[model samples]
Target: MSIFKSRVNTNSDTYNKNHADSLAAIETLRSLEQRAVTTSNKRRPVFEKRGQIPPHERLSRLLDPGLPFLQLHSLANYLVEDDNPETSIPGANLICGIGFIKGVRCMIWVDDSGIRAGSMTKTTMPTIISLQEIARRQKLPLVHLVESAGADLTTFLVESWAGSGGMFKNLARLSAAGIPTMVVLHGPSTAGGAYMPGMSDYVIGVKENGLAALAGAALVKAATGEVADERQLGGTEMHSTTSGLVEYLAEDDTHGLEIARDIVGRLNWNTRAKPPKRRPFDPPLYDPDELIGVVPKDYKASFDTREVIARLVDGSDFEEFKPRYGAATVCVQTSVMGYPCAMIGNNGPIDPQGATKAAQFFQLCDSANLPIIFLHNTTGYMVGTEYEQAGMIKHGAKMIQAVSNIRVPKISLYISASYGAGNYGMCGYAYEPDFLFSWPNSTSQVMGGEQASKTMGQIITAAAERRGEPVDQELIMREEKRIYDYFTKQESAFYTSGRVLDHGVIDPRDSRNVIGFALETCLEGRNRDLQPNAFGVSRM
Candidate 1:
């Protein structure tokens, strides 16, 4: 691995402008994630009065002190119908992330119950399913902080409800696959939602506050004319003493978290398997802050991908996989935070040769068991017959095939444009990267808005010519504007990320740390040992 020589002139006016733009984008990402918390915090008095711990606070307690918690999908469903997209404070009413619990890495899922009592929204189930999927693959223990209000009846969507069965199915599969799944009930989990604790390997419920029931008292009475209250019907006491649904009953939220920690410790998770040693070298030679200056907010603008790799890999050392061959697709073998991995980034369009280069690279990396980092910045597979005859489609498919079937962890970053087949080739969301993140300025769509509108304009003109009619330039202009506006609105990082397209929008400067954390998590999961059974832990 040779050191990447510096080329970015950070002192230039262009770089300075880029730096300013990047800062604003980062600020927006930070603000949106924080807005979700402040909105939930508005009900602090109500929760504290009821002897309940707020969701975020409970999460803090459960995680190891001072250790980083990679918050995922922070801005899930940020924009809503009829809300001003510009200022919409988005949250799925759930706080989900990966963090360490008692030195054991686990997926932490908390219901932001403070917001609408952490009601189940359309975004809720998918978010959890994504988290569960990550937990299953990463071999992470699932420790959920349950406190959701049941389904969001007000804005119910049949599709979400129909698809929700997969969530429980995944939970069952996690435990069956020898991954420990635990849930602590801090408050009410009613109706279908109660199944979360039922499927977990460990269940801890807060005494009076915890309630898991098929129906709350009002619903129960409405249907069966029963007079049982929540506490009497599904409190921790009853579950622990009589039904045996709850294995541990705690006095309060803090106490429940304590019990969860004790369970993790007792499981001897760390002792089950030896963690693979990693040679942690020094930080990148260049300042990560230079990343902002190096990457223009305009996704179309060209910038060397090595500028990013330099800021990310240890000691700015990039082992270029192929220096001159198929140069548009930059392939490199590198180490992020001492954990060895290979990175594939796009310099421009994925040409036929570049596509094959990347395909071969993915195969070699997978064989070496090194995690692959994808920095998405391609305009997609190159167009034009010169490349098509060169087998662009098939070659691009080979890259996608390799990315799709690779067994090693795939971590992706949407650095800029992630368009068309290039997205799939670079391991986009549908490819299911272990962690998918985006920079605030990143834009993703089938193609750029300008490009799509122009292509449509050309088609409209061609169709008009075929009919031997006068060119309707007005209509063409109208259609092009419409196409451009539609694509532009949806291509923003905020818009796609709000839909949970990627994990969340991240700051350019933190890419190294974030990627390193993901790599470490994947490594631990691959090595950790767990007890497997026919069904989820018997009692659960």
Candidate 2:
């Protein structure tokens, strides 16, 4: 492997400006995240009055200390209920991530019941379903911390309710795939939600607080003349004694989580070999913190994408593939966290040569069965008549096809712009990257706001000319700004991430470690053997 030399001037005026811009953008991201945390924490007093700890407290108790937890979609459904970021809560009212439990990697799915009793939002179902898919794909045993009031009826969508059958069905699927599914009932899992505990392979419930019933006590009383309390209907004791829904009943919530840890400890998962042995390597030569300044704040400004790859790869060493042939498209053979992998990145728009180059590189990586990391920062595939004639369409299609078919794990990271067909070719949200994440300052849009607005202005101005009338330049400018705002609002990493577009928005410096964790998970998932049976672990 060739060592990559650094070209970025750390103290240059341009670099300093980039650094300031990156910090502001990251601060904005942190502020939004803190809003969600504060909003949830407000319910602390309420929980304390009831003698129950908050949901996150339970999560922290469940996971092993000091081990990494890969939190996904921390900002799911941002600005959905309200445009005012100060007042609205995002994150699907769910704490979903991957973490180690007793040294065994497992999916951590905790309901943020602190927020309106963990009511479902518009994006809640899809976010959860997607996470469940991730868990299934990675073979991570799923452990749910259940406490919910079902759907938020005020913001209810009938389609969401109808589609929720998949949530229950997924538990069964997870079990059938020989992936263990467990749940700790922290509160009510009533109505159709009752199946959450019913379908799990293992279940722990807290007495006096936990309940899982086809109909909650109040619902049962309303439907029938016979009245019953929740304790008699679906309390942990009742299920442990008669219904067989809960295998373990605990004295309280903390004890329930303790039982869960013990259950994971007994799985004997550590005995199996997962990922390949780590290769020897040194840390990257440059500071990873320089990632903030590596990409210019202006989306259109050009920067060497390798400046980024240099900060991320092992020992700052990598071998560039087809360097001079399609200089715009960068493909490098490198490793993250001492695990060998390939990196395909964009320095500019993809031309025919760039597209073909990427396709060939994808083939090479696939043949070697090495994981591929896609670094996105492109306005799009180059356009114009000359490029069209050179077969940009077909060549771009070939690259997309290669990405789709690669059996090796694919991870997509948006370092900057991810626009138009370039997004598709780089394994954007739709292509099913094993894991996808973006920087706070990055964008995911069809095109840049300025370009989109200018094009709209041109179309409007052209129509006025055809009508034998003059268009007002001021009006056109206002129209342009309107279009610009619309596109920009939807494209921010915060906006798209809230809609379940990316796994999460991350600090640029943490890119190496975040991608390292993902690579490790993917490699282990790919190699772990599963014992498939006809049906999942259903209660006898």
Candidate 3:
């Protein structure tokens, strides 16, 4: 493999400016995450008083120490519930991520019951569905720390109710697909939420706090004139002894988490196949801290994407694929954390040659069974007469086709801008990459705000000129600003992340660890054998 030579000037004014800007953006992300943590932490006293562990603490205890946990959608419901942003909470009242449990990689979903008693918000269902999709595709075992109080009836909508069935459907699919679903009912899992533990392959319930009933006392009294205490109806003792809904019963939160971990350890999940051979790998020559300076805060400003690759891949060693042919679209074959992979990044727009090069590279990785990582930062495909005449459309289509049909694991990270069909060509979320994440400064849209404004303005002005009508300059300027503002707001990483455009916004420094984990997950799925059934295991 060829070692990638560095040409970046770390001391230059441009690099300093980019670094400062990136730091600010990263700070914004950090603050938002801190806010969510602070919001959840405030309820710890209450949870402790009730003899329950906080959601985050439960996750910490369950996961293997020192292992990387890639948290998803940390800011899921930001500024959505009310006009006053101060009162609105993020994270959809849930804490979900992928982490190692007893040396087995698994998806952990914890209900942030400390916050608002873990009421289900509008964003909750979609977040759970996204987690399920990841678990299914990546073949990761799923562990749910259930403590939700079910849906908030006051804000309920027919659409949410109709969509809620998808949660249970995915759970069933997971079982049939041979992915184990382990759930611990730390608190109430009533109404439709009762199915969370019922559909799981392994269920652990805490003694007095655990409850899984279709109808609680209030609901039963109102629906059938039957009165019963919640614990008597569906507590740990009742489920474990009477109904057999719960496979194990624990005395408290710590015991319950220990039981869940023991279940994962006993599954023999990792012994299904021989583990991949470990290879000695060198760390990148460049300091990962410099990653803050690599991606410019201003999306319009150009920077070398290789500076990014230099800090991420092992030993800064990268064998360029078609370097001279498609210079703008950089395709390099490199290893990440000792795992062989392909890295595709953009120096600028995707020209005809770039598209063809990327498509061919995709096929090459597929042939070699190497996972592909996308570092997205393109304005999009090039346009205009000369490029169009050169068959840009057809070439871009070929790139998209390769991305859609690739058999190997694909991961994407939005380093800066991901616009237009470039997003599709680079394996955006719509393409359903095995893992999709974004940097704090990343933005996504059909096009840049200024580009959208100018394009619309040109079209409107042209029509006015053709009609021999006087153009209202003020109105046109106002219209352009409106379009620009709209795109600018929606293109933010936070906004896109809140809307579930990607998996989550990650700190750039965590790129290598996250990518490594994701690649391992995909590899496990590819290697493991599953005993599939036409239908999933049922309660009966």
Across 1-540, the per-residue lDDT of candidate 1 in tens digits comes to 699888988789889989999999898888888888998999999999999888889999999999898989987877743247666767788898998899888889998988888887667777888899899888888999999887878887888778888988998899888988999999999888888888888899998889999889989999999899778799989999989999998999999999999999887788876786689698999999789999888877899999899999999997887779899889999898999999989888989889999999999988999899999999899999898899988998898899999999999999989999899999999999999999998999999999999999999999999999999999999999999999999999998887888888889898999999998888887887777878766672
Error of 3 at 64 (Å): 1.8
RMSD of 3: 1.6
Tens digits of per-residue lDDT for model 2, 370-487: 8999999998999999999999999999999998898999999998999999999999999999999989889989998989999999999999999989997998999999999999
Better structure of 2 and 3 per lDDT: 2
* Residue 351 lDDT (model 1): 93
Number of clashes found in candidate 1: 2
lDDT of 2: 0.90
The clash tally of candidate 3 reads: 0
lDDT tens string, model 3, 374-447? 99999999999999999999999999999999999999999999999999999998999998999989999999
* 1 or 2, greater by lDDT: 2
Score each candidate by Cα lDDT.
0.89, 0.90, 0.89
TM-score of each: 0.97, 0.97, 0.97
Clashes of each: 2, 2, 0
RMSD of each: 1.4, 1.4, 1.6
Candidate 2: list runs displaced more than 4 Å.
465-475
Better of 1 and 3 by lDDT: 3
> Residue 90's C-alpha lDDT in candidate 2?
76
